[model samples]
Every structure is written in structure tokens, then in C-alpha cells.
Target chain A: MTRALLIGNSHVGPYLNALKHAEGEVALDLDCIAAFGDGLERYTIEDGVFCGNILDPKVTGRKGKGPFPGSEVRAVLKDYDVVLLTGLRFSIFQVIRVFRDLGLVTMDSSRDYATAAENGVTLVSEALLHRLIAERLSGSLMMQIARDIRAATDAPILVLAQPRPTRQVLVEGTRFETFCNAEERGEGDFVSKTYERLAQELCAGIAAHYVPQPPGTIDGGMFTDTSYMMGTLRPPFWKKNGRPVDFRHGNARYGARMLKHVARELETL
Target chain B: MKNPYSDLPPKAFWKTGVVQTDKVHWPELFVPKFTISANSAVATAGSCFAQRIRQALADEEMPILDVEPAPAAVEGDLAREFGYGLHSARYGNIYTPRQLLELLQDMQKDAVHKALIWERDGRYVDMLRPNVEPDGCASVKEVLELRKQHLARLRELFETVDVFVFTLGLTEAWIHAPTGRCLPVAPGVIAGEYDPKLYRFHNFTHSELLKDLKAIRVLLRDIRKGVKIILTTSPVPITATASGDHALNASTYTKSTLRSVAGEMAMKFKDVDYFPGYEIVTTWARENPAYEANQRSIRPEVVAHVMAVFLDAYGLRKTGAADQAEPAKIHDDAEYLEGHDDDLVCEEILIEALQK
Candidate 1:
């Protein structure tokens, strides 16, 4: 069986759960090293070796969950032929910062931007975002991981971009989701192209790959379609007041769908 | 037997003018010919130093006209770094009055016929603004398309804006030899390859500077009949010179030429007003030193002082405006160089970096 270490932040949960229930002739054993918040910042290159006490939930909280990803994640990494890295520290907030600084959106232009985003406008072009991050944001987490992993092992790295926020995100209009929608509208391009360009550059930089979101998952060119997002998360989610948390995360079914795409691409690799 | 000096205000002399007390004396800085109201549509474009006022007015919740505003989702940081909120439109930095005039002309043109996209290391750059994009555009077509949209937005900004603020930054510029068009930066550093046959350095003389300033006035007049012009020279000195003289001498000559032209035009026009931003930073703080140790960058305190006097002199106070000026955000010279030293964006500073 081909062992695939799916290393990431919270996005790894669905993929791991999906592969667990999945039954197929496909020879892939999944392992994960997941953390939330600034967990990734701990895994630094110390004395020219790559390792971290990656299981400490107190330091990098698992959101009040039991049975954390095994402590042998770094050991498992060496045996895996491939590494799936998802959501390494980049946020939609960076997009908001870029958009605001560029004056693409003004104080009075919010409604127009929101409407445009609702209609599938991504304000920052994929090319522009790619170039900005590739050139200016080298200190980004993905960049660091790419460099460190390239140094540590012979196994190839495949970066899965963070999934698009759900349709409810746009419809409900939370501050974060609203910004994401506006970012999409203002950019005005196929949202997946951002992941592709970043992947292309990273691959060129470190001989790895960037796997874009499956084409069908994105609807109206900007957001993740509801079909892909429905009932995906486990333990569901909620606040202390018993209100359901408005997470943009998807379910194991969503991950199962994503896994099919990843398996197809791995055939060529 | 009253002498002419006897009747003059306290601001007339050096000792009684600014140095008599520790308290900030704002009476002498500016006496406006026309007041700026809260809803006044102010359009701003200039050298890097002009960004301070652009940001300050923005802070005061004044209506600074932004014709080509970024999509509303674009918050302050993104808008700031990528040429959005830096000026009235995304034209990057207009370092000189001539460049401003050229832009206004481009806006009026039915078709911007020859779009210049420079190529360096197989990537395309919008020659009009080489520094705006982090890397470069995908193609010449992309560059042309963005420039066309920029001009369209700029045309709108010029039309509706009641007040136009343009800062004069430099006298020296690289221009296309045939068309006399000003290049924001010298060729060969960021995008275009340098060709002596195609390009030449032109240190605009006082007459040339005045003519450009007057041409801008005329263009603004023709575009919007009642548009008022407020001129200021960027107090940030010419950090480096391509003129083959010492940087100190080049800066002195450049500042002198631009200042003289501004003074002459302000005196010559009914609508034009000259704010003492240059004097406030350079001459007024002779003892306290407005400039950093490098003598190139204007200190943050000085920037604060200049803008404070500016708002007090011109800013319209609504019912509950903040009375006291907040502590100014400071960017030292090293800090400015590492990140967005926007004032120097359009200038030919990159060439010096290339040499070393």
C-alpha cells in the first residue's frame, strides 16, 4: 500500500475521515498531522533537521477533540511516497488586505463589490495574486514548508489549496465571508487559477505539485458549490450558547470527492 | 513714521515668526483664499510625500475623489500597496507636473494609441507604472488593457474633483526621445532595457517646469472649468541624482527650480494656491531638523507638523471632529526602502540600486 501523509491544518480532517471509510483497490494508507491556529509555526528547521512536538493540543488546539493525529507524523512522513499539504497558513484576509490597499474597494463601494462577488467577481486577478505571493510573500507558511520538506526528503509534495467557502457563507454575509465574496468578484477570474499558478511556481521552485480544486466544486467561477459542501464536517460544530458554528468546512463526502481527483492526478505522477 | 516691518504680523520675522515659544503656532502657515468643505471632492496625485495628505484626508472622513476605486472587499492594506488609495486613481505616483499633464492628455485622447509595455526576464511590465505590480503583467495586451481602464478612471476623477492636489517631486526624468513623454522610472532597472538611442535624460529647467505646470493648469481648467489647483513641492529631497553632479547639488538645483516655478505660478494665478509644505519641512525646522540624519527623508514629526498645520488651515471641522492630532505613524529611511517608499516609486531611484 502507498502511504500518503496528509499534513495540514484543520482541512486535513475531512480528507482523513473520507479515506478511512473509503474502500477501493487504490493502495493508499492515510495519516495526518493536523493542528489549528499557529500550529505550523512550531515545525521549524532546527540544527538542519526537521521535526516538532506536533501532538501538543494545548499549544495548537484540536478544537476540543479526542484522539489527535498520531505523534509519529514526522516518522510516517519518511515512509510515505507522497505528502498532501492543505491550507498552510494563508488566509482570505491576505486577499482583503491586498484589495483594500489597492483601492479596488472604497468606503461606498461595498454593495457593488458584494453584488459583484455574489455574481462571481474575484477582485484580485489570479495572476496578480500569484505574482504578489510568489514575489513578495515568500515568508508565507507554504513557502517555508515547501523549502523544508524539499530539504528533508525525496518524497514529492502536493499542495491542496484551502477549499472555497460554502454558498451559505456568501448568502449569510458574515464579515469574513463577505470579504471573500468581494475578493472573488473584484478579482473576476476562475478562482481555481490562483491555486494553479501558486502550484506551478511552487513546483518549479521545489519539484513538487499543486493540486487545484476539482472543477465541479466551484460554481459561478468563484465559490464552492453547495453540493460539494453539504453535510461534510464531523462532530458538527457549535458555540457555548448552543448556536451552530458557521464553518466554511466540508464533510467526509466532500473529502471523498476531492480524493477521487487526487487519485486521478497521482496516476500520472 | 511707521516702517513697513512695523505693521507686519508676528510671522514676518525669523525670531518672532516660529521660534518665540514652545507651543505650536499655526497662524502663519496658511490663510486660505477659499475654504474646503466636508463634501468637497478633493482629487490628489503627486510624489510619494503627497500620500500623507491623501491618507490624512481619508482619516478625517473627507470625500477625496477616487474614480477607479478598488472593489469594496479590498480593505486598506491591499488598496494601499497595489496603487489603489495612493492617489485619486491607480496611476501609481505622478512624480512631476509634466507627468500629470501627460496623464490628463492621455485621459482626453480617444484612443491611447501606443501602449508601452516593457519586457524584462520574459515578463511584461506596464511601463507607466513598473513598481505597481509585484512581478509583471502576463502580456503586453494585459498591460495595455489595464492602462486603458486606468486612463478612463482618471478621466472621471478629473471631471468631478473640485480640488486638485499635485506635488512637484523632481526636475530630472527619463523621457522617450521622440515623443518627449516622461518615463516614470529610467529604463533597464525594472522592465525595459536601456537604449541610449531611444531614451535620454532631461533635467527640466525652470521654463520647462513652469510651462508644464501652466499646461496642467490649462488642462485642469479645460476639463473642469471651476477646478482649483493646490501645489506643493515634496520636501523629500532627491535621494540620488542621475545628473552626474553630487546628490546634494542635484537636489538643491531640482528643489530650487521646482519651488521657483511653483512660487511664480502661485503668484501668477488667481486659482492656484501654494501650501508651505516645502518650507514647513525644510526651512521652518532649520534648528529642529525636519529631515532625518540622511538629510533625504522628512522626519515623521515634521510630516505630522506639516499635515497638522495643513488640516488646521484647510480642514473643515464638523461638529465632533478630533481636536488633537494623533501620534504620527513613522517610517524611518531604512523602513521606507524595505517596503513601500512610495514617494520614490516614480522617481529614478532604482537605477542607483542597480549600479551598486
Candidate 2:
């Protein structure tokens, strides 16, 4: 039986489910190793088996830890043929700081400016924090884990690039008022520019295959898409002028599309 | 009043003049001629009601242009604080046709202008003085000179726009002090400080709305003379108004006036159509009598139904097929999950924190 191991951020969960459904429909005998959690932790693989925590206790702590432990990751990877990675959350604060320092973002809101010290710290830390983590826990760390697992059984390592879902374009005439309101509040410039930059960066990274998932798509199941769903899940308890107004995120339709894309990728793997 | 359904024949039995049968055949209230199919490049912009239009069209599988620069921040507060997508106030109103035209004008005049200003920093940054891109017209005169050129492009876009839908959001707006520019909301609402002397509320008279419609039509005709325009009045009420009128009364007056304007325009123009999006949503589809939440937005399901009717009438194709199959099972997953699940808690905290 061909075994596949999937790991990454929240995006991996939906993709794994999609792959499973597709395999069932196609009648393929494929055992899959699916591990999805925060990317800040280390996953371990041992003696032809995937085991160990998918998240490091030191990094995430118990409250923020993954559903499983590091031993499970090691055991799962040992028996899996491939590992896939994707993230739903992006550190937009960091991207905004980059642009702000570069003079791309000009306007600062009272709140943004008031918290500038705190935000600055977050921005600085995020920029520097990921690289060190990558050195100790990612890149070579994953490679090392794979090598160790391979010592017991030889399996090809296929790291698929994350899929970048299509961005939500503001419908003309509708979003302008809200956008302008944000601007007046002082945080407008920083918030708008930073978020946009973050999307572009995410899309660019996914397009470039710098992040892992599948070619030609970004993970839409991430926190970004789900947040929309949460916001609009229920219509606002009150409305004005008889028109129902609510913000939206990823509906089931978008989720389905992302799932199908993952299913197609699973076929290739 | 002549029956609007006069053109529609009964689906079941045809009667000569007035034959009656037990089988009642009500003509489909709306029949969509097309669906938003996959691979279509769709763009939506207009007024606040346009948001509903976009959502509905998106649900039907139509591709909406992601004008929001950043659409991938996992944290709600960060997304809001950063200004990703259409939800930010910095983009400053997506509903105004004039503003949309102005933005396009800027982009056309300067090739890099939009990318530099709107698409940079992952969001649209507020520009007190918008700079023209190098490839665009150098002066305001040059920009005006290219009005015809821009109009042509807009017309072309309209022709290919399988569904050219818009919502007449308001009959009231604030005009800029110095430039005499019309803004959808008051300066203090979005950007610029509120200076009573600089901003004055102007409730558009029938004549002004008619004039604007004519101008818009003329501009559109320059692009695609045969393009169809679908207009609707926003049913969402006003939260607060500087007009001295009570909020409820103001909302009613604005919506009624806009609805009448849309109806008149539809009658005057053959290619123009008016959809009872307001009536269908507020009355026919409303499950709640109040019609809004405390914040004054419409219910999601009501909006969904309004859009479904729109698609039914327009016959537009849907864009994303892989996305829509099995709505039931998907909704089931959400139902099965507890209210305060991990995802929910995180999102709730994020959105609440960000609002601050």
C-alpha cells in the first residue's frame, strides 16, 4: 500500500480529506499520514515509522500544542512516502513593518501609532524569529528526519508547494465607504497597505512554490478564509434600511474548490 | 397598471384572451439567461448593495476580481488593521460610480499608478494627492482629455461583463468643500476631519439622479452601446445621518427615492432593467421583521435569496463548479462542530481584538 504523509499548517487538513475522498471515489488503496498544526514546532520520524509530536511542546506549550505529540509525527513519517506543508495564518504585522520601514506605508492611525512600540516589537520579532526557527526546526531539520526515516526504508521526499486561493476582490461601489471609514480612523493606511502586501506576498510565495502545497493554488482553508465564514456565519442581529449587511469569508463553495484542487494533486502524488 | 408580466406566457396552459384552468401557471418571476461559468474574469463594484451582489454572484460561481490587495491574513484583527481586501475603510467606498471611474481614470492615465498606490503595501493606501503613473497622462487636463478613451474601455468591459449589476445605494451624499467632489460618505466617516463648513449633505433630487443616470448611460454607450445595465436600490438602512431626520425615516426615504429612480430609469431605457432586490429582500425574504441587526446590515440568507433571484432572472453562467457541489454536507460539518470550537474561539478573539 502506498503511504503518504502530509504535514503543514491548517491547510493540510482539508487537502488530506480531499485526497481521502478522491481516493475512495477512484478506489485507490493508499494509506495516508496526515498531520496538521502550527508550523512553529518540530516533528520527528523514527525507524521506518512516523512518531513524535507534530508540534514541539517547547515552542507551542500545552495550551497551543497540536492534536498529537512529536512521537506520532516520527512514527507517521517513517511509513509515509511524501510530506505536504501549508499555512493558513500569515504574520501580516511583519510584512507591514517591512513596508513601513521602506516607506511604503505612510499613514498611521491613533491606535496604530499609540501601539507603535508594541507593534514594532512584534514586527521585528516575527522577521527574525522565523529564520532561526527554520534553521533549528525546518529545512535541514525535516531533511534530517527524512534521512533518519530513510535509514530504515527508502522513500521519495516530495514537498508540494502550498496552494494560493484566489484573493477576494472588493466589489466596486460596495467596499468604498467601509475603506474610507477605516482611513479616517487613522489605522486605515497601515491596515490596508499591510494586509494587501501580505496577500500579495502569500500569493507570490505560493506561485513561486516557496511554500508547500500543490502547484497553481494557495491554501484557502487557512485562518484567513475561515475567518470570513465565522464573521458571516450568522446574519447581523440588526440591519439598516431593510438591507442585510454582513462581511463574508470562505463559503462552502470555495472550500469545495480548494478540496478538489487538493484531490487532483493527490492523484499525481 | 399594466401587468409587468404581460410579456410572459403561462407555463402550463395557453388561453385565448381569458381561458381559465385549475392548473395555475405563474411565470417564473426571474429567469437567468446565463450562469457564471469557470474561467470567466468577473469584476464587481458599485455601492454597499454591490457587496450583496458580489456575494451572490460569487455563490453562483462567478469570479469576482480581488481588488483587495491582501486577502490572506489568518488573523481577523490583523487583516482589518492591515487593510486587506474590501473590508478596510482606507479603500474609501467601493460603491460610487464616479469614484470607480476616477480610479480607473487614474490607472489608465498612469500604468503603474494603481499598482503603486492601490495594490502596494498589500492594501490601498489613502492618498491625499493621488499621483499619476509615468505611463499615464501627465496633467488633469490630459486625464480629462482621455475620458473618451476610458469610456470606451469601460464600455468594452461592460459588454463582456456577463452580469453588469449595480445597486443605487444612496440619494444622499456629502460633497467635498474645495474641489466640489461628491463623496459617498461624509469626510469624518472615512477620511479627513469633519469640518461642517467644508462638508454639506446633498440629497439628490430626481433631476440630479436622472442626470447622473444619463451621464453614466452616455459614458457606457461610448464603450458598448448595446450593453445591459441592471440596477437595484440598497435596502440596508442608514446607521446615522447628518440630515437631521431620524435614522429610520432617512433610510426609508433614501431607499424609496432610489427605488423610484431605478424604476424610472428602467422604463426610460430599453437596455436598462430594474430588479426588486429591495422588496424581495426586505419584505418577501425577511425572516425577521426588524430587517436588520443593531449595526443595521441585512441578514445573510435574505441577501442570498435576492442574489439567487437575480441569477434566475439574468440567466448568467456560474464560474466555479468544483466549489458548489454538495452544500448540505458542508453546512452539516459546521453544524456538527461546537459553537466555541478551537477555530471559533481564535477567530472571535481575533475579530474582537482587532475592532479595538
Candidate 3:
């Protein structure tokens, strides 16, 4: 069994669930550690050890689950065969910021921003993607996180593109519908593809394996299917945008799908 | 013989005023009609050169009023590329007063127009200031919605800013024929079809420049009680011209007309002040070919001198006597001189891409 430190923000939840339901005896022992928002902003590198956040007894962790690790927990990364450095979902929003800058949308209103991204498309393969993201890799937390772990442990690092946010229709006039209304084939696909492509290139530059999001997870476009996200999430922004879209974390089924992809890729490696 | 020169201050003689040793220092280069104190909120508009003022103000830690600032997480050149923190609002590169005035009108909310959006490759571009968003908006609704907030912010700027540093970059402009809306880049440069019927080119004469400046003055009259104007003509030459004349000859006509108009406006209005930024840069570049080899991009050191002189004359930063000893080079804005992120997006640069 390959001991893997499945470390990231809320995305770790689905991955953990994926482990519990893996086919036959899954050959991966997962240890998850994460904080939400800038929750780990307090963490620091003290001496040779990553230290801090987990030290705080009061941090309501990813989804208010208790006891996510501090910087010191990075020590355990040495024991793992592959360290999965994942997200606080920074890449998606960064892509949103880029589109907003490009003036492709009139409003930074979440609905308009989301609609633009959900509908935008770009035809980029890994080499082209790597070129686009190579310059920006160091600037992202995922790469920084992996680099920091590399400084302490020689474990191979693998990264995943932030799983697509829930695109469910919990409400009749949700913002996703606003995005759907605005969607075209190429332009809408461009936005999500930009993030995935950027993430893949960034991970590769850091010598980390870039595990793409599970196939069929994205429904013939940039969006994750509402089916994968339906039960495993809580919709914080639900009903406000006239849809209960959990634009952040995904459910267990989504995690299992992500893990299956990662395992399949690892087997090939 | 008490001619104007004989009785004038020492600064009147070239040897004393500008040329020789003990030449009048940065502050004496042009006495500011109004002081821009450290905290005074400043707004910059018009031309690519105007962006230098915003950056210098930010470097000085002066309160540059950027209402459409890129979000905090979007830092450095990437933020700049997105067209954030370029001006007081997201009104990107107001290359002429007409464009500036159009933005002011758009801010009125009622004056917002639907016809300004330009399309290329199935994407909608905000023709008014096209470069700010390179990819164009996904939908017309997105464009309008983004513009509504942008206009709201522009309206707020009149109330917020103490100084408006407006640089006149060009006399030649392309506008929508029927609507007369000023397009930032000539259509087909950034993203638009150059339709002869819909788009018409006009090289503004001195009268047109004066009339447009006065129009801006009239609009400013009602907006805020005491907004100071520091008008300057950009020393950066136009990259290409549609005028039948040589681009160099066209550049002379553009700069001269803008200078004359600026001088006229300053003379006509008490609040409007014309700074000799044009003379400073052009003269310095003549003495030392301070432009890049292409003769289009002004060397970063030249930009440094412009900022240093301006800062010494008006704001909190004053050039030291030793510093002014080299009056030809205002070296205070060293980061700009370092030229790290100075590959500014000049619409004129797009002329190379235009099908010649």
C-alpha cells in the first residue's frame, strides 16, 4: 500500500470518502490535513519544521470538521509515496479574475463571472498548457505548498486541478443558469480549460504529477456534472443566486471519482 | 533695456533657466499652481504615458484614487494586464479629451449607450477602452453590467480626486461615425472591423482640441468645486498614422496642436495648469537619445526624470540640491528607471499587427 498524504483544503473530504469505498483492497493509505480559507495563513516554518495552524485548538477546520494538522504535520509527508498537494480552489477564482480583467464580462457579479467561465473555452494541449502556466506556477499556493514539502521530504508530489465546483440546479434561477444562458461551445469551455491546463503545467514544473480531474466528471464542458456533486455538499450560496450551487467543495462521490483517476494514473506511472 | 527677459526671474534665461550650471532646479522647472500634498487624491487619464503618473504616485505612497483596482490577490503585472489600477476607474487609456469626456458622460448613468461594443472572432470588446480587457466580454449583458459599475466609479472619481493629471496623447482618433463615440484603439487594432461607413478617422486640429478641452472644462465645472487640472502633452510619439503625411510629420502636428490647445486652456481657466512635461522629456531625449533604438519607446530613465521633476515641483518629494546638480536627469524614481514591468500596452504598437 502506498501511504499518501492527501493534503489540501476542502477537496480532501471527497478523497477521504474515496478511500473508504475503494475497489478490492485499495493500495493507498491516506492521511488528510487541511484548513479552510486563509485558515492556515497563521502556519509558519519554524526551524526545519512547518508549524502553527494545527496548534490552534479553536480552528473549525474544512467544513467545520475538527483537528486538521499544523505545519509540523508536514513531517509525515516523508512516509508517503506520493504527496497530493491540492486546493483552496485558488485556480478557478484566479481564472475568473483573468476573464474579468479581459473585459469578457461586464460585471464581476458572481453570476456573470461564473457564466463567463462556465461557457468559455480554449483549445490547449499539455505542452501549450505548460507554457501558459510555467510562468505563474510559483505564484500559486499549490506549487508553493509542494515546494515547501519538497524542502523537507523527497516524496514524489502529485497535484490535481481544483475539482470543478458544484453546478447543480437546486434552485430554479440559479447563477449557473445565468452562466448556462451565456454559454457558447468554445468561449465557455475556454475558462475551465485555462485553469486545468494552467494547473497541469504548474504541477509538472514543480516535478509533481498533474492528475487531471476524473473523466465524465465534467459534462462535455468545463462544469462538473451536478450528479457527482448532488448529495456530498452543502450549498452556502444556495437560493441567493436563485440556485443552491455549492460553488466551493464537492461531495464524497466526486472525491471517489478523483481518487480513482489518481490511482489509475499512478498505476500507469 | 528692461525687456520682459531683462526684468524676469533668473529662470527666464536659458543659461540660468535651463541650460547651464546653476540652472533652475526641478521645483523652478514649473511652479505648480496648486500643490499636490502627499495625501491629496490624484486621478490620471489620457494616453499610455499617463500610467507612469499612477505608478509614481503609488511608489510615493500617495493616495492614487483607483476605484476599479484589481483585487488584492491579483498582484503585480498580472493586475496591470487586467486593466486594474491604471486610472481612477477602469476607463482604460483615455487617449483624447473626447474619450475622457465620453467616460464622464457615461458615468451619468442616463448617458450610457449600447452601441459602443465592438466584436471580433465572436467576442465583444468594449470599444471605448478596448485593451483593458483583451479577450472581450462573453455577452453584451456582461459588457453593459461591467460598464455600469465602471461608470459609477468614474462618477465617484470627480468627487474623490483632488488632482486630475490629463495627458493629451494624440490628435488623431477613430470614432463611430453615427454616434461619434471615441474608440480607444482604431477599429481593427485590438478587436473590431474597420468599416468605412461606421468608423471615421479625424485628425483633430487646434480648434478641435481647444473645443474638446473646453467641453471637458464645462463638465468639470459642475462635478466638483475645486478639482485641479495638470494638463500635459505626452512626449511619446504616435506609432503610426492614418494621415497622408509621414508618421514623424504627423507626430509634430499632433503634439504641437495639443500643446497649443493646452496652453490656451491653461490661459483661459484659472484651475487648469499646463505643465511642461513635453518640453522636459523631448529636450532631454534630444540631448541624449533617451528613446529605445526603435525611437518609439521612451527609455525608462527618461520616465524617471519626468516623475522626479513632477514630484519635486508639487508633491512631498523634493529633489535635493546635490540631486538637482544633475538637472538634466531626475533620477529619483529609480524603480521606473529599473524598468522591471514597463512593457506598457500602447495601442500604437498594434499598428504593426494591422494589415499594412
What's model 2's overall lDDT?
A: 0.43
List the candidate numbers ranked by lDDT, top first.
Answer: 3, 1, 2
- The TM-scores, one per candidate, come to 0.73, 0.44, 0.66
Q: What's the TM for model 1?
A: 0.73
Q: What shift in Å separates residue B25 of candidate 3 from its native position after superposition?
A: 3.2
True contacts kept of each: 0.09, 0.00, 0.12
The runs of at least 3 residues in candidate 2 whose Cα sits more than 4 Å from the true structure, single-residue gaps closed, are A1-269, B1-27, B31-42, B65-92, B95-162, B284-290, B293-295, B315-356
- Which segments of candidate 3 are over 4 A away from where they belong? A1-269, B1-4, B21-27, B284-287, B318-341, B353-356
CAPRI grade, predicted model 3: incorrect
Query: lDDT per model, in order?
Result: 0.67, 0.43, 0.67
Question: Proportion of native contacts in model 1?
Answer: 0.09
User: What's the DockQ of model 1?
Assistant: 0.13
Please provide, for model 2 over B119-212, each residue's C-alpha lDDT reduced to its tens digit, 9 standing for 90 to 100.
Answer: 2322222322221111222233222322322233343455555445666776666666555556554543332456678766687777777767
Computed on C-alphas against the true complex, the DockQ of each candidate is 0.13, 0.02, 0.12
Q: Residue B180 of model 3: what lDDT?
A: 81
Residue-by-residue lDDT tens digits, candidate 3, B7-79: 7876676765666533223437778777888879888887988887777777778888887776544567665
Docking class of predicted structure 2: incorrect
- For candidate 2, write residues A52-145 as lDDT tens digits: 3455446756544454222133444444554433342332322332333211113342122223333331111122222222222233333344
